[model samples]
Structures are given as structure tokens and as C-alpha cells.
Target: MTKLTRTLALSIFALAAGTAGAMPRPMDAGRVIMSDTADRDVAIDTSTRWVNVTNGQTVRFDVGGQRFTFVFDAWPSTDSVPLSAIAPKGVTVPDVRVYIAPNPLYQD
Candidate 1:
């Protein structure tokens, strides 16, 4: 192959590699915050607003002078559900702080 053709092919390959690395991975169904309950520490992924909790886990959020507690059952667990599904009607997920306790919540 001509030197010019080889150089152009290599340049295209390098560009594709760089762009692929720059592209962000699709956010998880939601973000997982491990709430040990001792330390009010919070872990969040700014990309998604969904929150997931497991059984025996408690998640609380205060909004508009009201507090909401979500208690999951031991079984029939909700693997992943949008924060809006549990939050008070008309409450936007982005406006609320999602807290999830340590449990069997899986991460991919």
C-alpha cells in the first residue's frame, strides 16, 4: 500500500478509538447509593434520576414539608424502579434526594 494511504487508514483508526473512549456508557437503570445509616454519606450518578432499593431497606426523602418512606418487602422485590414511581405524585425525581441502604442491590 502507498505510504499516504497507510497513514490515512491509521489516522481514521486512531480517531475512532479516541471517540469510542470519549463516549459515555449508558447510565445504569438508575444510581445506587449505599446508605449504611451510620454515616449520612451519599453516592449518586448525575446521569440518571432513578433509585433502586432492596427488601428490608428503608429509603426516606423529605419534600414540601412531607416525608416519604419506602419499605421494600423481603420478596417480590423491585429490582429497579424509577424514583418517580414511589415519590409523591407530581414530585420530580431530580428535585428529591434518593437514599438507598446497603443490601443485595446489584451493580453492573
Candidate 2:
């Protein structure tokens, strides 16, 4: 191939690759609630939400007027509490467990 044609083809390929890499992925939608170290009760009427609880933090969720408290068992690491954790206690929603974590299958 000629020098100019080769340069144009390479530029197009680079642009296409960059565009593909920049494409956005579908993300799950939910409310994120962060708690402090002190133990306290939080009222959450919403059916869907994610709670990030730190070590020594106890969060009580009042779902649908019923109270359900979950204490962080692991120390020194924050725990990702999905809606299912509180569902068995009192929270009403579709019976499903959704655990969100770093995608191990992801590639840079």
C-alpha cells in the first residue's frame, strides 16, 4: 500500500478501536447509602437500594414500616449489602440476590 493510504487506514483503525473501548456498559441502578462508624437506625422506604457499611457500623433499615438491622460482621473492610440481605428480615421485594463486585472477567 502507498504511504498516504497506509497512514489513513491506520488512523481509521485507531479511531474505531478507541471508540469501541469508550463505549459505555449498562449499569445497575440503585440508591447508595453510606453509614458512619456509629450505630444508628436509618429509615429507607424505597424497595431497591445498596448499603455500604463500614467496620463497626451498624445500620438499621426500616423497610415498609418494618425495621431490620444488619451489623457488619467483618472488620477493617467495607461490606456491600444488597437488598437481599434485608429482604428476609422484613423488606418486601422480588426474591433475588444481586451481589455487585469487581468484575473478575474484566480486561484492561
Candidate 3:
């Protein structure tokens, strides 16, 4: 194989292997909620739409230029929550579902 071709193959292999970690799914506001799964397509980018949180922990994520913090008071929930539950009184977040950590499959 040519040197450039071999390097390109290796780079592609490395990129695929590195992104095998679980990624959260995205949902539009007012849309029906679907079961959360890590085996989603690579094309969908939900990086900013979700937040991973731990038991009794607080997680903060940004949408646009604003920051929002969510305290997992109701941790151990099997479902996601709306931004209104965590957002400040007047700031309106986008139509997205926020999920906490402990993705179940990773739990004991």
C-alpha cells in the first residue's frame, strides 16, 4: 500500500474506534418521547441536547450562549425531563429532553 493510503486507512480506523462510546439521542419539543438507547446512528449530533448526571449531582450544559444547571433532586428516574424543570423563570430553552447519567446498561 502507498504511504499516504496507509495513513488514511489508519486515521479512519482510529476515528471509528474512538467514537464507539454511547451517545444520547435528540428529541424535538412536543414530540413523542422514545426509548433511550446508545445504539444510535452516527449522523445525529445530540451533544448539546443532553446532559449526563449522577446520583445527587448537578450538571450544567449550554444552549446557545446561556447556561443551565440541573440538580438531580429526582435522580434514578427512568425518563428524561423538560428544560422548564431546571431552567430559570424567564429563560426559555430549546425543545430538547435532558437525560441524566447511569444509563442503566453501565450500571451494576
Candidate 4:
């Protein structure tokens, strides 16, 4: 089931992006702030896992056993969504927000 879930997730998300000609910057990446509540804390370590998704596009992420899906509403002024807002019918997931920054981008 994990293998199948991984395969399905990989096929659904467009993960490859070119950063060759990007403007002079220390780093270009986005962070997914996960939580069970609306409040978020700043990370002491300046790094995060990143993903490149088109503006206004809906994205799905299968983390652990939870399925999180949300729309990248083009760099929102406040980019955070609660599980209640994104859940399908009775299904629920964690909170997720994506934006630029440097953070630990690790795969588990």
C-alpha cells in the first residue's frame, strides 16, 4: 500500500523545476508549515523541504498516512489552510502552507 501510494503521489505531482537562470539570491525554496492548529512558530534553523508548484494549482501530498491536499493560491498574503477547509467529505488532514525560504529539505 505504501508503494502504491508513493507511485500515485509521484505521478500526480510535477516535481522537476529549473533554477539555472534564477536571480541572484541566497536560496529559492518553499516550506510546508504543518500543524493541528492555526498558530505557527518560527523555525530556529533556516531551512525547509521545498516543492515547486504552479500558481493557483491544487496540490496533494501524502505524508506518513495522512493525505494533505490544498491549492497554491499564488503566494497568498497569509498562506495557511486548516484541515477543515481542505478535507474531502469526511476525510481530514493536517495544515499546510508553502512559501519561499531556506530550510531542511529532507525525505523520510
Candidate 5:
């Protein structure tokens, strides 16, 4: 191939790769609320619209007019561990979990 053709092809390839690796712009505030209240490490992946937390990383959130806390326990198999929360009675919790595909969301 000619040098010009090769350069154009390389440029296109690089642009495509960059676009593929680019992360989506998160439309919401996303963060991992880590609470070390025990010997656990929780990593809450809320960008996916679910509170998928890991061991020990607990996310504290406020729903309605009350506050709620989600805790992830360490147990068998450590792949994609889920999290749970304790909510007060008669309160509606919003879906605070947000998953911006292509990459994990972050807050500034």
C-alpha cells in the first residue's frame, strides 16, 4: 500500500479504537460509599442501576425523608458479590444505582 493510504488506515484504526475504549458520560452522580464498620470491603457498582456491592463497602443513602444503609457481606465465592440495605419502615427508596456502560461511572 502507498504511504498515504497506510497513514490514513492507521489513523482510522486509532480513532476507532479510541472510540471503542471511550467510557460513556454518566448522566447522574455516581460514587462508592465505603463503610468499614466490619472486616468487609464493599465496592458498590451502582452505575448498573442496582446496588451491586462487594464485601465491606457499604453505601449510605437517603430515600424519601429517611436514611438507609446497604451492606455487603463477605462469604463464599467472591465474584460479583451483591449488596443489601436496611431501610426504615414506610419509606420509598429511589434507584440510586447507576450503570453507565462502556466504563464505570465516577464522581468529581
Candidate 6:
């Protein structure tokens, strides 16, 4: 191959490797905080390896070998479901606000 073509191919390969190496790492477990209309603080902890839900809200998560699903409505009106019961094994919980909930509750 010509010198110019060889250099071009090398540059492309380097760029591809760099891009692939820069991908973001996945999370294991954490809290997601949000604000209410009244500016009240709310947070969810995924430390239990499951998704938690509260006040008739839905909990959903995709982790390891388990497809996580939960509902807080089964609990008392003042109660919330714990994440430990629903989270997958060895899966990290991200703090990102990727899920939608009509009602949010803070965990202690």
C-alpha cells in the first residue's frame, strides 16, 4: 500500500479504538433524587439490587438475570416498596432520572 493510504488507515483505526474505549461505565446501586412541585426532596435507593416503589407508583428495572418489576400500591398508603426485593443480582443502580413516576417518595 502507498504511504498515504497506510497513514489514513492507521488514523481511522486509532479513532475507532478511542471511541470504543470511551464508552461510559454502568452503575451497580445508588440513589436518584428529584424535586416535587412544592420543591420537596425525594430519593430512591437501589442498594437492595431491586427497584423500589411507593404510593401506587410503578418500579421497573432491567438487571443481570432477572427482569425486575414492582408495585407500591400493595403496601399501605404510607408505605413504599423496598428495592432489595426487586433488584437483580450484582446489577448496579444508576442515579440517572431515566424512569417516569406519577408519584415519588423518599427513602430513609
On lDDT, the leading prediction is 3
Summarize candidate 3's per-residue lDDT along 13-103 as a digit string, tens digits: 9999978852322222122222232222111123445544443444554455555444444434334665555555565666555554554
Per-residue CA lDDT of model 4 for 1-108, tens digit only, reads: 699998987766634323433332211222333433322222211233433444444455554445545444423333333333434445443343344222123213
Task: Give the per-residue lDDT digits (tens) of candidate 6, residues 20-41.
Answer: 8452211222222232222222
TM-score for model 4? 0.28
RMSD score of candidate 4 (Å) = 17.1
* Cα shift from native, residue 48, model 4 (Å): 7.5
- Model 3: weakest 10-residue lDDT segment is 24-33
Candidate 5 regions exceeding 4 Å error are 1-48, 74-85, 94-108
| Lowest lDDT block of 10, candidate 1 | 23-32
Give the TM-score of each candidate: 0.34, 0.39, 0.39, 0.28, 0.29, 0.26
Q: List the global CA lDDT of all models.
A: 0.45, 0.47, 0.48, 0.39, 0.41, 0.40
Name the candidate, 2 or 5, with the larger lDDT value.
2
Q: What is the lDDT of residue 28 in candidate 2?
A: 24
Instruction: Report the Cα lDDT for residue 79, model 6.
Output: 28
Error of 3 at 26 (Å): 20
Candidate 4's C-alpha runs over 4 A off are 1-48, 75-97, 100-108
76, model 2: CA deviation in Å?
A: 7.4
Candidate ranking (TM-score, best to worst): 3, 2, 1, 5, 4, 6
The alpha-carbon RMSD values of the candidates against the true structure, listed in the order shown, are 11.3, 13.0, 13.0, 17.1, 13.7, 13.7
Tens-digit lDDT string for candidate 1 (1-108): 999999999999999999974522213222223343422222333454544454455555444444455554322322444455455556445532233333555423
* Order of quality (lDDT): 3, 2, 1, 5, 6, 4
Question: Which consecutive 10 residues in model 2 have the weakest lDDT in total?
Answer: 23-32
Q: Model 5: which ten-residue window has the lowest total lDDT?
A: 98-107
